[model samples]
Target: MCLCCFLDDGPGSLREGCRRREPLWIVFEVSGTINLVSQLSVSSYKTIDGRGQRIKVAGKGLRLKECEHVIVCNLEFEGGRGHDIDGIQIKPNSRHIWIDRCSLRDYDDGLIDITRQSTDITVSRCYFAQHDKTMLIGADASHVGDRCIRVTIHHCFFNGTRQRHPRLRFGKVHLYNNYTRNWGIYAICASVEAQIYSQCNIYEAGQKKKTFEFYTEKAADREGSSSGFIRSEGDVLLKGAQPCLLQGVGENCVFRPSEYYPTWTLESPLDSLKDILQICTGWQAVPRPAEMLIVA
Candidate 1:
């Protein structure tokens, strides 16, 4: 139903609606910003759909902890402050999530973090700008449980984000048809047994031209030779973006998206692809009902 609460803290609030046990398709009737006092913890089987109305969530962020079957679409997340606070965090056994067409920026920590055995996620058509530590897949080297993480990030725009276009620890990540530009340190990182498949993506560098960075960390499970692996196919690097030196990491075999899903939209990394991402990604305006009907 609709979140008619413009204040965002009432009984008919977005927080209360998300706390409900039953599945809900939560939409917004009001067009305004919600300054969350704390982290908005979402329940299982919920869809926070923000179409037709421009809804911005700031101050705090969303925490998807130990939940499943969530879809966050067409929302704007900005100015998340505090220690270890992320714009959107999916962790600790959360699965089957799709974060699509959202704009996230200026977070104290990561914009989006999927870690701690979270899997079956797809982040598509989202825009990330003016943030640092952008998106992180796995938590760290010590968290070996993150080896089960499998994420697909496609058709997203990473605009001038400072690092971690998604730095992972140990996981299988699929990066396809995405655009990342003007990163401060590095564009994509694979650390400690992570497998990344970069297919038909564009990486444009501005001042600092380092595109790929790899690090070897000791995982809790592994004994020796702990390093990440990435296989790039048909990716475009521009503006003096340096190519990755460590091309062959793990036996020249990285997991491909075609092995799992049957089909997906694919495009060549052309210069015009930058225009498509800037124009089409992030929140969009659509038609919706004028009246608010909150589900009980």
Candidate 2:
């Protein structure tokens, strides 16, 4: 069923719905916290739409493994624990995914991680806070399968996270209109053949000043695999946000988002970004749809 009316049957009902082969739109009938014992696996062609109600998933998180065409929206994730745990983990050939308006915090490993050949994903309007290792785009240099990964991250608020505002490896990431502030370590990292295009982002720093860093790793290709490429344009740096630790590397990149996807929503940097990202990003309170408003 589309509506998860009760959890007396346990969270398996929702997990089972995600495992179904056919397309499904999953929504909740009740608003509360789901304390998962393990990572919930999401199958293909599913939309976990958490709009109109407040829903929080804690303890364990989600795993999107080898699936495609999934849309996750307006969910709050926190308190994910244990080894290799992430608020959302997409990996091993999954594609065509979108994660929007989610608030993720205090995960053991990372808030979101896309790796192992996964591609064609977009993360937008999400808020990340109170965590280290915020996001990781690729697995490692040995997993050459990550070469085809293409991701777009936009309108996200990275608030006081420790590091990896997304560390990239062997992928192309289009980052735009994101507000990142008060980072503990470095803000963004480029490692091992990653192509990152950062545009119109606002970076406000506290203590740690480096905005970008390059990690050296030997790529599986065995070519000139010293570091990745990052190109930043129209980015605003404020309050001691250093322009990239690796200078001369931010420019001279071939990958551009416009060449792949034609259009995307973008806002001007600085005060506008600070205002909008703080107010509009993350899980929103929306009215329930008429179909779910049935009187019982």
Candidate 3:
């Protein structure tokens, strides 16, 4: 069964109505903001679809306290000038969740945080701009045991104004085809037992800035790995034609694009990367990253 409705035009109380329905599909038609202080608790089979740019969810936005199979798409979450106004907060034991095609900005804790035993999640095609902390996959490795939550972040853009924690703790994370610019420290940091597969991602620092860095302590360093897969066509490193740092280990996993992705006008290096990885890994066809930008 499928359900579809709008939240903006609904009269009376929106939260009361939403609470009553367990499985629902809500669409936001108006262009106002809604503040959620405690939590906008959703059921397992609920989807909140913001119809185009008509709705803006203000305040702390949706907090999936302990829900599963919930999907949120195509909305803007404004923190509204305060701290801890996180866009989406996923508590522990939440699974099978998807957050796609949304813009979250100006928050204190983080744009999206998965804390306390959360697993099997996907965050794709989202834009996180002007955030206090960009994306926190795990709160603390100590609290979540040795196994950190597993997440896939594909085709997202994070414009960090300051040093933000992209992925904290340790987990199996696939960060593919994302763009990050103007960060104070590491673009993506994996502290403990993290198997990070990064491919076709672009990282740009401000003037006279560095690209990427990784850190780990001796006790927390339990086989944390970082690998660079392939480069995009417009990668600045490819055009510069310098010696690339193809691979490195923890505490030394800093990759500069200009070194590996040097531009060669004669041959298309970007196109060749696809075929190269296939022959080595025996993977059939490479997948293109998601495109999240929508201009109307």
Best by TM-score: 1
Quote each prediction's TM-score: 0.95, 0.93, 0.69
* Candidate 3, run of 10 with poorest lDDT: 280-289
Q: Write the per-residue lDDT of candidate 1 for residues 48-152, one digit (tens) a residue.
A: 989889999999899999999999999999999899899999988999999999999999999999998999999999999998899999988889888789999
- Which prediction has more favorable TM-score, 2 or 3? 2
Model 2 spans with C-alpha error above 4 angstroms: 5-12, 245-252, 289-296
TM-score of 1: 0.95
Which 10-residue window in model 1 sums to the lowest lDDT? 287-296
Candidate 1 stretches with Cα past 4 Å from truth are 248-252, 289-296
Per-residue lDDT of candidate 2, residues 1-296 (tens digit): 45554342344366777778988888877788878788889999998888878889888889999999999999999999899999999988999999999999999999999999999999999999999999999978999889899999999999999999889998999999999999998889999888888889998999999999899999877976578888888889999898854434534563878889888877789696699899989999976566753321
Q: Report how far residue 20 has shifted in candidate 2, in Å.
A: 1.3
lDDT of 3 by residue, 1-296 (tens): 21223343234334544454467665533445666555566667666666443456666556676678888777777764455556788886788888877777877667788777787788876777776567776666456352546677766666654554366555556556566666655566655444555556655565425444445533333354332221123333322222223333443342332332364122222444433322322111222223432211
lDDT by candidate, in order shown: 0.89, 0.87, 0.56
* Between candidates 2 and 3, the lDDT winner: 2
